[model samples]
Target chain A: MAANISEETLKVSYEQLSDLEKEFEENEVEIIRHQVALNKPLYEKREKILSELPGFWPLVLEQAPPDVDQYIQPSDSAVLLSSLKNLTVSHFEIDNGGKGDPRSIAIRLEFNENEYFEDAVLEKKLWHRRAKSGWTGLVSEPVPIRWKKPGKDLTQGLLDLVVKVWEEDKKRGPGAAPITKAKDYTPAQKELKKKIETVSMGGVSFFGWFGFRGFPISEEESRAATAKDRENRRLRAEGKAVPDDEDDEEDEDEDEDDDPYGLEIFPDGDELAIAISEDLWPSAIKYFTSAQETGDMSDIDFEDGMDEDDEDEEEEEEEAKGGKEPPAKKRKA
Target chain B: MAANISEETLKVSYEQLSDLEKEFEENEVEIIRHQVALNKPLYEKREKILSELPGFWPLVLEQAPPDVDQYIQPSDSAVLLSSLKNLTVSHFEIDNGGKGDPRSIAIRLEFNENEYFEDAVLEKKLWHRRAKSGWTGLVSEPVPIRWKKPGKDLTQGLLDLVVKVWEEDKKRGPGAAPITKAKDYTPAQKELKKKIETVSMGGVSFFGWFGFRGFPISEEESRAATAKDRENRRLRAEGKAVPDDEDDEEDEDEDEDDDPYGLEIFPDGDELAIAISEDLWPSAIKYFTSAQETGDMSDIDFEDGMDEDDEDEEEEEEEAKGGKEPPAKKRKA
Candidate 1:
């Protein structure tokens, strides 16, 4: 019986083994099919590129270039012309007094040499028209010529224009131009243009005049204007017309009380107060008196009337009521 | 004559004064009209809010919960429980052969202790039902319980379920249920569930059976598989019948040399010659001689027959032509 049982067990295991083998064959075929499907196209492209490009290695082994140097510098003419070109006159003013050929006319020019020279020369016609109306010109002497540390040359066009202008001025008539002496003319024009151009490039306006002209009001001047305004306002508030400067300076210095009007009652009042302060005062006084009369001065003096004893009583009441005030009584108080 | 000139000057000045005054009055009126035209309503709601809010702040104040301290504690039970409540167990696997039960299942449950405990017990029942219907019966233990820390009492419902399962097992008597010991029930169930959950999370197949459940193939097993694959390929290439592992080891070793046809000769010639060490030269020569007549001595000794001087001359010619032979010549050489 044991031998029979073993034989029967062997037969059952053989049947199981056949079934597993068939399954494994089918699975392996499926796996191979999937792998070929994934890799075939990739392998085909790799093979094609490799087979077609045999000599690619030799072509990649070629030769190459070497190294060198370069830089820049400015010419002396450029330096000189650039400085002179910077001198300029921008606008002019004339106080003609309604007559006499605009006597004492003042001219304002930008202080850059290059731009000023261009305006005066190549663009000379622009200022010449203005000059025809009888304004003489004056320019500040050029400040010491300082080249920009890394000196870059002025443009060829500007340099050419400066030379042309100088030639034209010389041809016009001997000594007819303000710029005289060949040495003085070239270096001075060049230096002036360079300084003016450089300074103007630095964003400064150069202003000068042949006759009297107002600079920007200095701090002292602004203060003087303010003081004069204050004095004028004070005189007008007192119903007194401000006398001209010829008036006795001592009389003007009199104390505020000597004013003809009793405006001295509010000496501290300014133009704002003079116009509206008095009108508002009576209404203000009325409101104050009514507040005082009613003994409801909470708006004026919030804690003044409540005595220390009253405060103590309030605190005690709060403690008695569980650290809170009774709502209606608190409201009334 | 001087008096007449002075009178004329005075007359002209007077006329100019009247004209200037008229122009000034006109300008004053124009300026006033311009000022009135430019007046605009200045009030705006956004501006009012910007000015009136304390510190002129922009965003509205948000009053959040006052007890920020509550979030800082590490062992807050409610926080742990809430996080666990959101915990999701998405899939599971049962340990069974193909005939026992379905391999996979998914679960979603709230954190109620009673519900979690009921679900854990029911999972086994579900597997049993599938098993009775001709599917594999996979025995799985319950999942391990994780908490904020160990030694904390299991959730009330989980503890209750453990007690119930233990009581049921005792009532059923020995061998009636898969879970036998009351002491072992909880941990066994936990370990099974955790394994299934871990495999499911990683998105890998969960194959469970015998002692090898969850055991991955070792590196040695992978190398053996690769070797088997190579042997199969060799059989396919040589058009030989692939043998199973049942082949006698002695016969298989002898078969390595039994290349009945010379089909493998061309593809493997270089590699076989290199692999045959000096000690194996006699055997290699015998195999080669037996494979063919004369062995084509001309092709075998071709490199040896070329004279050294001729080879040098050819190399010099190649060097003269840029040290690069054309692709076809290089291949032939």
Candidate 2:
């Protein structure tokens, strides 16, 4: 029955739906603004309560939703538990007088003095902005983490490589943006390939997320998106529709394949950031309380049915192989 | 450090946070109301466009999000694709003067003449009602399907059993509600165990969803929730805090185990309903267009790398063992 339907008819209807969707989106933004204002005092109270309870953030992070939790390796978990003092996610653009996106947020992770890193604080700010291609989303840049020793680098130098790549790419003349094709920088691509392999569990370190700068799209891909925007406007003006070019989409996918560094390292960075800011941050008390109920960080179990004691033993075994254990546990011993 | 903090302090802070969360929720309802009004015309337009495109809803269902898609077995898919003509989800209580819950919805599925059932339309209305426990969510009742033959029952008699159980339970005294423990009805529990084992793929049929009433909570469970509500109010009056009874919660979980029929059959029914109504229904055109791009129902692949031709072959093999294929494909062949 779909075979009998003309492409032009479907396109016209699809465009109409798209117009409706835009209206829905604009209305949703208004709701978000109201929520941001209403949640201010609640968030402030949450901050106070969390501070009163030590080791709260660590417990919350241990039971982080699966999306964000997957990025945190066992070594990363050890580091976070030992030093993570507090966590706060703020809608930084909330009070920007409608000039900024309300959804744009800053995630701050404060740490006590630790053996692993020299820095007392690490923060990643995501700005909700639109691209030249007419797509709007949260975009971020790499934040440097000052590891006391190379051996203590939780991201296994992946973050360093990303920083180096961005700096070098920026040095390239105009039009050579940070999120360009990896093939343009063959030397960095060779290094990235080696670094990615060293990462385990089909995911990068939680620390590596600090380097996320959003997904890359080539000039060709951007132009295609722009063309679609033009076509949609033209269809509205002409009061008719034509079949969309599927070939262009296929080519865009092929171009995406050329740049795998940022995508591979933090493919769902924006989503993960949103998840953390919107869900994990506000619900810290709930998550922390649940984690407390278990009497063990059972929610963090990636492997099948591993007990806390078993995990502790495994951590020791991992330490023998040059990994680190939570120093607080060692201090208790 | 948590060991040093008084339980009273934590409890007081948690209650304060809960109060704030309630405010956030009330604000959210306002947003949802605005969206419902703004979307009225858009949904009407969507209905018109969807009617023009044949097999559109089938294709959209074929590409449904994992949450909803998981419930649809291959046999169920064959039935839906063959007969499903139109699907609509409406916020039925939206226009009702503020007394009615705006979130209450009705999901309507229309079908063409088919050999499976006598009914041309199967509609399930889920009312957003508050339970005796003060918990509010979508509550529904079984909408019976008149199967033409015993062999043609897509739910394989689960719906029939559920209906019988509900009817029998309703006949009991006022205290013995529908969601009570399965132990109350020994004969039904025995039959349910038998029917449950026969259901494949750790899920029930798409047709079985017609019988989804919501998660079960016994009278004992309701009293516990009400008691907590009472305690919170008392605490507010007294301006003091007390630790919540973890023992009570443990007992609630134990009681839930005694009533496994509804929970086992549709553990996430409320969540699934929300996903369908909010995401799938509004995004039908997008899902359908993407399905058209593949030209095959690759999104519905349960087994690894199974092509359309392979699926058809498997269907034929299954049919030889007493099943049916989508008659449209059969006619084409």
Candidate 3:
């Protein structure tokens, strides 16, 4: 007979089990809660920065004309100048063309008081171009700018400082308060604005100018261009608007009537008799045969009599439906 | 005087420039085509495989009875039979127990003959259980069958072979074709059919006996059971179920609420508490307070008195708006 367990003993065992289970469940819940707590602040901070940056754009734009506006009013330029009035003036310089007229132009620029020495120096150089015009004006060159630190505020400070420097140079130059209508810009300012416009339009890498070029064209675009060129040539041959260039005359010599191989073009100008490089023919054959098997003949145009084997297979299939067996296979000699 | 260059020499240089440009463009187009050729086969293979796998489900389901469609089926005592047909046989066996004679049952199952060895073995075992009813009748544990090596036409070969095996087994056993009505089923045929259904339902695992014990109880059922237990206890305490046993009860401890932690019993008599560990509280509080100061309060429930500081700050802001200067240096001593 089984021994009877005491109620107190049973209760103690039950309490221990209950405690273990409770602890396990609480740990699970706490772990999830702790992970959420750890991640929530980071997620919120990222979201806040993203939202605030876009909001800051409007404030930045308030100090300058809209980028898309073709004409920048002198009043808009004045507003831009006023925004930078409290910035510290780093230096005052007048560019005297070596031709000996010191008073020919005098321009003064105030750098942001909080800007670093290197940034202030760069801003001073950038401002010097704002005083010239026409062929004699300075041309804009891509210069690398390094930040003093990594935070969003520091990056924004640098951008604001650059804009302030440009504003000061514009405001202090020449005859009128509204500088846009002043009828003349130092050739340098005009060139700088044009370069800025190009950068904004192309979004090309600055490194591209120094042997990097632009991002390579995508494969899809290249293929599309080739296909379009092929189609244009075809349409022109059929009397379309495509111009008759020398290449069109060359293409006519390579049209093949019964070429089993699917070469798009032949250098020898005789598609049927032209020999492919030994290395290329195997790949050509594989492509053609696979395409034929898959019924994807759009890439290759076969002559009527060239695909006799396909026709024979179709005829045999029809005969089989009529209760006739296909012909015996031919034996190889 | 500077010498004038000949038109022929200039034309030759111009032609060479045009040729170089044309060659560069052609090379770019060729590179694009080669890339497309490389990727095309992989895409085609992926597409082909994706289109083929979805067709296997219906074939798998065909071996089971069309109507026996529960993810889990329940039987008396929760003893799940290996197959739907076996369940039917068990039901018949239970129903016929009171009768003088055991009833004869026939089961038929169809399955893919070319499946792996484990699958065929499982199928055969499940079907055999219908006829055997208990563990004493089989020769050995069934092994899943697979197609022969170089598996061409193996599906048809296995189907024919299984039918032959069933016929031979029937011929060797007496009265194996047990039917009240006139019918023929060799013991092996009945066994094979049951196995097929089993294999279809459980695959190669053959773990039908455990029968999904870990499945969660439904919330509704749990709630109902708790309510029922509470009512029954209440009635018993009031001397409704048994009057004599009531006086035999020891002093009922109504001091249950005296436990300081307020632990509660769930319907299943499982206890839960929301108490924090005394050892961890100091560290938790320090971590939480530091997180709050750093704008990273992801853990604490600052839902009640914690917001009082924020309200006080708002009041100070309102006073400041009304031209009162904020107090400086209110650091705690």
Chain B TM-score list for all models: 0.17, 0.74, 0.16
Best by lDDT: 2
* Backbone clash numbers for all candidates listed: 47, 0, 19
The candidate maximizing DockQ is 2
Q: For each candidate in the order shown, give its overall lDDT on alpha carbons.
A: 0.27, 0.64, 0.26
Pick out the ten consecutive residues of candidate 2 chain B with the lowest summed lDDT.
B324-333
Candidate 3: regions farther than 4 A off: A1-9, A45-333, B1-333
Identify the runs in model 1 with alpha carbons over 4 angstroms from their true place: A1-333, B1-7, B42-333
lDDT digits (tens) for residues A1-333 of candidate 3: 011234455343433332232233234333323333343343343334323222222222222111111122333333322322211111122221122211111111222333322243232111111110100111121222344454412222323333343455447763333223213444444443344444335332211111110111222433454455546545644656755455445534533442211110111111101111111111222222232333343543432233435544544343322212111111000
Say which prediction, candidate 1 or candidate 2, comes out ahead on TM-score: 2
Residue B7 deviation, candidate 3, in Å? 57
Instruction: Compose the digit string of candidate 2's lDDT tens values, residues B245-283.
Output: 665576456564454333345544565676678768866
Residue-by-residue lDDT tens digits, candidate 1, A1-333? 001113344343333332332333234334333333343343343324323322211111100000000000123223222332221111122121232111111122222344223333221101111121111121111111122332332332233333444455457665352442334445534454454455434322111101111111223433454356456646754757776653235434645433121101111112111111111211222222222222332453322465434544554443332232111111111
lDDT score for residue A38 of model 1: 40
Clashes of 1: 47
